[model samples]
Target: MAVTIFLLIVAAGAILFIYQTFLRDKWIRQKPFPAQHEAILSCNLPIYPALGEDQQHRLKQLILLFLTRKQFYGCAGLEITDEIRITIAGQACLLLLNKGWQTYPKLLSVLVYPSAFRAERDQMQDNGTVAIARHDLLGESWSNGKVILSWDDVEKGVSDFGDGHNVVLHEFAHQLDGLSGSTNGAPPLRSNSYQSWARVFTENFEDLRHRSQRGLATVMDQYGTTNPAEFFAVATEAFFEQPWQLQKARPELFAELQAYYRLDPREWQRSTEND
Candidate 1:
């Protein structure tokens, strides 16, 4: 009886330890972020003014989420300021405004560099050998819960959102796509919508590939023609940048993206412009 009582005490202690640890971590993550961080707003994008009062408040909340939940560090002594944090988090949360942003689960860390970063990739040999090569990247995403980006490109991406090239959106889109256990362009989809997404995306992807092969000037980015996965990322950049153009050029593809992202920036632009 004494042994059993001692065992229960041990179990209770273990449970309490775990609970305290979890609570501590959660409390730390919920800490409110400061309003002014030098880096966060350093490179403000022109599009920021278009956000309404409520949207602005939501953006502020997201900045705190990013600061508390993600790990960010500066390279070469580049200090991360509140503005930079807010800027990146605002754009990332833009995609989630109309939908459940939390759908992008499993992502845990974001690493920022002062500029383009270098990484090594291992090449496979025909005889089951591996060769390593160094490569430079503006941004990269890993399935193991990490994202790397260049600060220069991050600012450029925000400013050039209308141009359909954003590193943050591109990488985060990959994260969302990989949630279903693969990095292919196809992420988890509602059962009823998969058929349409597959059909429209495949048809458009193939068409883009064919046009690029023929050296035809395509509406979507030529980089998207590289692969279905890339096509999705590239298209996402374009969708956020030039929504009307995408809608006009590829209505079906635009519709799929609209359904997926749930917020139509084109409409936002129209409403804002009219005001």
Candidate 2:
């Protein structure tokens, strides 16, 4: 009887795990995303047109999951509309297209403001002094599952897809980096690729820092030199917005991102170059 009871307990535990991981996701996928959301994606997101049919379908599913799972709040007396929700969801979901169908498990709410917002931050001075400072920001992501954004910047990013400065993508990338239990620029990696990821990221990060210090023109934004976490976020913006340039300027770094994202935005860009 003891052995039978032990076996029954193990079986029940296995069932629960399977349901949480697989069955729940399957159920979410089965639900339909609203038809109006499709129009929003097609109109606002330039990358939507470059995706293949299968990829588009997958992206739609991811967007649906994101919209369903995450809540959006308009701040500074701005009213949240379907356009705001759909636009943000579409871009945020694009990052997960090939990475996984899993919606951002850590992110639960998005706070949006009318324009650039001021944030009060505590700063440490060179003389070992602490000072409070106020700075303007376009977006920020927190480890506690909250993201703040300037709707104005978000609109600008979607409208100017080639600029390589996407506030939404940049902040979301930080969330991805935090998945590894810290936001040190490196996200969780497959066991087989962790060593390669570390080496490539470190080398590229150092090179960027050196270039910034020397005042050299860099293909990547100099803001990436801020830290490893910022590097990953800025690199993500370049990866999606200026794929061809990034691939040409830093093939190895691009390759590392390609391997991690499992999608080739450069190829997508090439295919649509004539359009």
lDDT leader: 2
Error of 1 at 24 (Å): 11
Model 1 RMSD in Å is: 4.6
For residues 1-275, what per-residue lDDT tens digits would candidate 1 score against the true structure?
Answer: 99999999999999999899668655654665464642344346445556666665555555555556677666666787765666666667676666643625576777788998889899998898999978889988789888778889988887666777888888888887888799889988878999999899999999998999999877788989888889898888888878898899899999999988776778667755877
Taking the tens digit of each residue's C-alpha lDDT, what string does model 2 give over 1-275? 99999999999999999779777677777887778888899889987887899988898888878877899999999999999998998888888988877788999999999999999999999999999999999999999999999999999999998789999999999999999999998899888988998899999999999999999988899999999999999999999999888888888999999988888887667767868
Question: Relative to the unseen true structure, what is the C-alpha lDDT of residue 251 in candidate 1, on a scale of 0 to 100?
Answer: 96
TM-score of 1: 0.81
Task: Mark the regions of model 1 whose C-alpha exceeds 4 Å error after superposition.
Answer: 1-43, 101-103, 125-129
